[model samples]
Target: MSDSHELSRRDFIKVTTGIVGGLIGAIIGLPSVFYLIDPALQEGGKDAWVPIGKFEDMQVGTPYPFSFTRVQVNGWERTASSFGGYAVRKSDSPDDLLILNSKCTHLACTVNWSAEAQAYLCPCHDAKFSMEGEVVDGPPPRALDIYEEHRISEDGIIEIFFKAG
Candidate 1:
C-alpha cells in the first residue's frame, strides 16, 4: 500500500525559493534598517571643548558676553542648542582668561552682568554674584558654574568645555 503524501518537485522548488528569497531580503534590508536607527540608540551625554572667541576679543577688566551654537546628539536626533557664557580677560595675558557659564546656580536663570550694580544679576530669583563668581547676595547655594577646563588655542581663541547641568 503506497500512502504517498510526498511533495511534488514544483511545490518543493516554490518552498525553497520562498526561504531563499526571505533570507536574501533580510541580508539586504536588515542593515539599512539598523543604520537608520543606530543614531537614535547612541549615548547622548557627551561634551567637548569648543572655541567661543578670540582671547583678544575679551576686554580687560570686563566680562565679555559670548554665545555659541553646537550640535547635541540626543536619542533619535541631532539638535543645535545655543549656549551662552562670559569670557573675562583680567589682563593682557591670555592665561588670565576666565570662562564662566551664564546660567545662575540658584535656579538656572540667565544672569546678566550689571555695571551699575557691579554684579552678575539673576532677575528671576534675585541672586547676585560678584565679578569673580562669588555669591554676593540673595538666594544662591554656590558660585556661578565656571568652566573647569579651558585654554587659549594656539590661534589665541578662548576655548572651554561646556557641560550642561
Candidate 2:
C-alpha cells in the first residue's frame, strides 16, 4: 500500500508539472505565433517621403499622377501596397501647390476630375469639389483631402508627405 501511494503521488506531480508547463508555453508562444501570421496588427503608420517626381513635368493647373508604396503590418507579417493619386500645381505663387487625394470624403470612393463640369466629382454619392479642393456640393462633409507638398529644389523636384489613415 505504501509503494502504491508513492507512485500515485509521483504521477500526480508529473501531471501537474505538464499542465503548468503547457500553460506557460501557450502564454509566451501564442502572441509570437499570431505575430508571425499577421504583421499589420503590430503598428500603424510609418513616416516616409512620397516622391512626386520632376516638377518640370507637372503642368500648372493640371493634375499629375503620382504613386507610392505603403507597408502594412498585421502582427509579424508585412505587406507592401501601392497607392496612386493626382496632384496639381495650382499656382506659381510661393508654396502654391496642392496635392488632392482622389478619395471622396463621404464613403471613400474615387473622385474624378470632370473637365466638362469643372469640378471633382464623386459618382458614388454625387459629391463635388471645386478645382481648389473645396467642397462645392454633395455628401462630403469637408473639402477633398490635401497632402503636404514642398519642392526639394528650386529646379522643380517636389516631394509630398502623405499620412496613411
- Give the top-scoring candidate (lDDT): 1
Candidate 1: give the clashing pairs.
Answer: none
The TM-score values for the models, in the order shown, are 0.68, 0.66
Worst ten in a row by lDDT for model 2: 1-10
Tens digit of per-residue lDDT, candidate 1, span 33-94 = 99999876766656778888887778987899988887876666878877788887777876
Residue 126, candidate 2: how far off, in angstroms? 1.4
RMSD of each: 5.7, 5.3
- List the candidate 1 regions with Cα displacement exceeding 4 Å: 1-41, 163-165
Residue lDDT tens for model 2, 30-111: 9888877664454576766777778778778777767777887655778887666667778776466787778888898888
Model 1, residue 129: C-alpha shift (Å): 0.8
